[model samples]
Target: MIPRMGAGVVRNGRELVKGMSAAVPIAIGYVPIAVAFGVIARQSGLPFAETVLMSMMVFAGASQFMAVQMATAGALGMEIIFATLVLNFRHFIMSLSLMDRLKDVPLLAKGALAFGVTDETFAVAAMDEKGGNGRIHPLYMAGLIAVAYGSWVFGTVVGGLFAGVIPRSISDSMNIALYAMFIALLVPAVRKRWRVGAIALIGMALNALFGLFLSGGWATVLATVAAAGCGTMLMPREEPPAAEKTAG
Candidate 1:
């Protein structure tokens, strides 16, 4: 038992190293955007501590930005919570999918893992699992999450601290960096799957239409749901013939 436990520890350590290495690109991508978020949150009247706290607790970039925007616009607490919830609904789907890959993990570990499962981390883990025939090392995932989380928190602190030092014009321009980061993530996925591009366009159009008559958060929620429904309906699925199943 002692030998076996020692081997397990060694294996997990190696896996952690690999996970951290794989997370370098994600860390790099998160820094500028997180800094931008920090800057925006600070400029929008959030205290430096609150800005960092949001990054630590919320962790989702888009939702954090929306929360900051809503808060700055004097939105009510309930409204802010609802908007954040709506925007982060995708995390539920991502977490469910990841659960299948982590069936052998303990509930406590799974809970911790769920908190770190951002879009970028999900993408990386999914690809890694696929390439490894569905075997993802939990320690590796922990390492990946640690690096990404640390980078985001650190970036937010740095941005918040420098918010006063940076010129107003430059700080305002940092807002575009978030959108550019999103576009960078989206374009590659759309290129790989044409359906993704169609869904994105549909969402954009619907959001625009809804924006004309509704609140920003509600418009976003409705457009997202509509686009997802359309995408589900349009997605192609293959069905094997009855004869093929019988032959087996």
Candidate 2:
């Protein structure tokens, strides 16, 4: 069923392949971060099984790390829960955008698809327009999720088991990988709107200023909120296709 269609059809295999292809960057992108999570989780005194299980269930890198840190600090259960919720609020917005793209699908399909709704998948799927040549195949999302999800889980286990073998020099370098991943993710939007460059610059400036002025983590939240608000306000309107412009 997943192999029979083309780019314009949601069921087309090509679209699925395209989706999977797009997800490749994401798969590679998460490796270092996911490994770092496992490393930190192990270092934090969490049992290996518990660490892996957390990655499996939460499957959310930042929130999982934050939760473990809070837990290790003997923070209250409610505090841990609140922290996780706050960290995951962005995913809720990502999911909402995905829902509109998948509006024509069946409820069961949507429900199942929602399980795979990570930030990476959301970013790729948002590029697909309904009834367009690059229409999103529901199964493509399924396949991409399967691969990316497996990489994350696998990376976590490997990182946890071999955390000791990874040298400090290597571990320190892994942090840069996150910024590279983000740059790749933003490339598409950047291509579409040069104005996005301004948003990113402003957001980074505010983030640095806030981090210097406020407590740790407050800068991230404030800068993100401010940048998103500003980006939305300055977002460019869709221009007519070149062919349409010529016809007119």
Candidate 3:
């Protein structure tokens, strides 16, 4: 059964409201960025329908922006698909992290809830102490997603429709913003492992070399696969902790 707040027992709808409240910050941030994506997409030659559909279906903000940028860079359709898959591989870890918290949820409920998980949503839900003593209810998560998702789509639509009024300079710069985000995400991991930095440069170099001869997106796809395979072989495996290794 879903947990409740207060003594007398609150309704499920109330939990959803709490979730919406929690997502306010995410909505605020998403709107401007999403709006920027909208304007950039329109300026980048994506039609309104495709722009909105990408948001609606993909729902991963960083990957969406990257997709648009890659398309602009002459990446082929298959290359774009493969790139997004590699980038979003982190979703596997995120989903696994939530498994314990939502373990008892029915499979269908789990499926619905998983669809709503994002970096923001996961962070919010992980820290949230709602639903009685640090538990998260499916409904609350649903509410959180509803607001965030709506804001993203709404901002995309607004930007797409208003692309003309927005300065061409601003929309053009959004193409570069996604990589800035990537750098921010990359810096922390690079700090942990120099191999990560080496692997990244290797991928970049490989792409450049391959792009000289390959067409469409195959160069990027091949480069990514090759770099990742090298990382797997070169990066050291993490051993079990000393205490855990000795416990049994």
Candidate 4:
């Protein structure tokens, strides 16, 4: 339904809520993994507050887990920063992809939006493209990021405060959520687009090959760039649907 000027506020509210609803699956996967990260950080001799603070600040799952593990081993500050910088190199690509898609979003808002573009959020936003307007609404993007960002911080607090209280077996098993969430997102897209499936397979193969010699960070970046190039050149491009003209 088209909203009157007065209803703009209500329309915005609905879009925000809708975006948050769409991210529930992501939250389910993230919370458990975040909790595990918190437990591991605490057990690895990180202070409880710092563990939660890391989640709030870094917000990158794999990097956070790796950083805590590295820190536990008595790594130097510069070493930890360099390792995380390498690990999170993929964020550069993710940020660029989002920037292109969100042409209508405000310039000031883009930075905040980019900060929230994790792997899961990027996947969901890409799949949920706003075809009609050719741009995602800023409020929707905000809500999506809010859920994911909030869940990680909240879970960290829970796990940090009660590190040993949570059973190690349960924390260990939470890793399954990570894989399961990817499969859940992947199957639907692959069913609709064979090219997506093919590109995914190629990425996996290239990552495996590169992993043999390169560090995981470098391997992932290279494989992703290669697979993206493959898709760009090989996949058939479809133009956006034309907008229907209406009498003014």
Candidate 5:
């Protein structure tokens, strides 16, 4: 059997409180960014109804931003739809892991909860500790997701309502918040593989190098390709333990 840990335990009321507390900065940072998304969507000629509908339906911050951008760029509807599918393909893997953790829950409840499985929610849920009996509480996972869902919905509304009031410089500064959120999400995962860390550093360097040379969004696309290549090449593979010799 794979080694197990209390990876899903809240430990106590305090740990639950701590996890919720950590989510506060995420909420605050998301406010301005979500607002920017709404403003941009509105500027792109999507009416409030359509904008809100996309937010509610898609429920993915990055994918929604990318979708709006592609739409604004006059990409075909099929292209936009395909791009969203490719971008969220990771969700399938995350869902499998979440399903194992939440296997004991009722099917209806599991189906409803699965809708909230975003990157942030998946990260929180994946880290929940296993219990002595190896079952993790679905409620803890739900609690984590509920906290993030509140922030996302609330931030979308705030951004939609106050988009015009946000200044250009303030909007520029918000980019740092995005970087901060990425780092916060990344650091923990980095501990598992030095190659992962190295690839990230290399990707950042290459992205900067290409950003200086190329125009438009080529830098991001190139960096993503480079990172994927590096990860596939350098990430370690685990080997199965040898079977014990039979006693003579």
Candidate 6:
């Protein structure tokens, strides 16, 4: 029993190391964006502590940017919350997909993994060969989450603390960095999947139309839903034949 337990511990540690290793690129990518968020939040009149707190509490990059923009635009509390909710709704689908792959994991671990499921992390996990077997090591996931979370939080704190020393012009220019990051994330996806480009174009057009008639937040939500709904309907679906399915 003692030997078995020892072996289990060693295996778990190795899994964790592998997970952290996989997350290195993601951590590096997050640092600049997290720093940008911190700087922008500070320039938008958020206190240093609040800026860090927002990073800690709401770790989603796009949502954090939206929150800061809405707050600065004099949006109501409910409006900000609703807009953030709509923006993050895709996480629900990501979590559901991971759930099927990680069903063997404990509920507590699943909850923790769910909290850490950012777009980058989800992409990493989904593309992993081990995920093809429908089993993801929880310890490895924990390691990935820990490193990525630490990098983001640390970067936010550093940026917020030093924001006061940055010149006003430079600080103002940092706002564009957020959009640049979004474009960087988008371009690769559009390249890999032509449908992504179509969806994005549709979303942009819908957003413009909606913006002329509705508030910013409402327009964004409506555009997202309309584009996604259209894409789902237009995208092809592959279904296995009924005889093959039964044989399996």
lDDT top scorer: 1
TM-score on alpha carbons, each prediction: 0.88, 0.66, 0.81, 0.69, 0.67, 0.91
**Clashing residue pairs found in predicted model 5:** 6-129, 6-130, 7-128, 7-129, 7-130, 8-128, 8-129, 8-130, 9-129, 35-159
Candidate 1: segments with Cα more than 4 A from true spot: 129-133, 238-248
Instruction: Rate residue 156 of model 2 by lDDT.
Output: 90
All models: lDDT? 0.87, 0.75, 0.84, 0.80, 0.68, 0.86
List ranges where model 3 is wrong by over 4 Å. 1-18, 127-135
If the candidates were sorted by their TM-score against the true structure, best first, what order would they fall in? 6, 1, 3, 4, 5, 2
Kindly list the per-residue Cα lDDT of model 2 for residues 133-187, writing each as its tens digit.
4445677777777777888898899889997777767765655545665687578
Clashes of each: 0, 2, 0, 0, 10, 0
Candidate 6 per-residue lDDT, tens place, 97-157, comes to 8877887888887988898999888888877657358578888888888899889998898
lDDT of 3 by residue, 66-143 (tens): 788789988878878987888777787887777567767898888777877888889898887654656677778889
- Measured by TM-score, how close is model 2 to the native structure? 0.66
Superior by TM-score: candidate 1 or candidate 4: 1
- Order the candidate numbers by lDDT, best to worst: 1, 6, 3, 4, 2, 5
Error of 6 at 76 (Å): 2.2
Which ten-residue region of model 4 has the weakest summed lDDT?
Answer: 239-248
Stretches > 4 Å off in candidate 2: 1-29, 44-50, 61-90, 100-109, 123-138, 239-248
Candidate 5 lDDT over residue span 158-231, tens digit each: 66666567665665455454456567657877986667778889888887988798632555566667776887
lDDT of 1 by residue, 1-248 (tens): 99999999998899899889989999998898888888888988899998999999889998888788777766677767876786688899998888788888999999999999999999898887645669688888899999999999999999999998888898889878767867987899888789888998999999999989987767777888899899898778767899998997
Give per-model CA RMSD. 2.7, 5.7, 3.6, 6.1, 7.5, 2.2
Clashing pairs in 3: none
State the lDDT at 198 in candidate 6: 91
lDDT value, candidate 6, whole model:
0.86
Which candidate has the top score in TM-score? 6
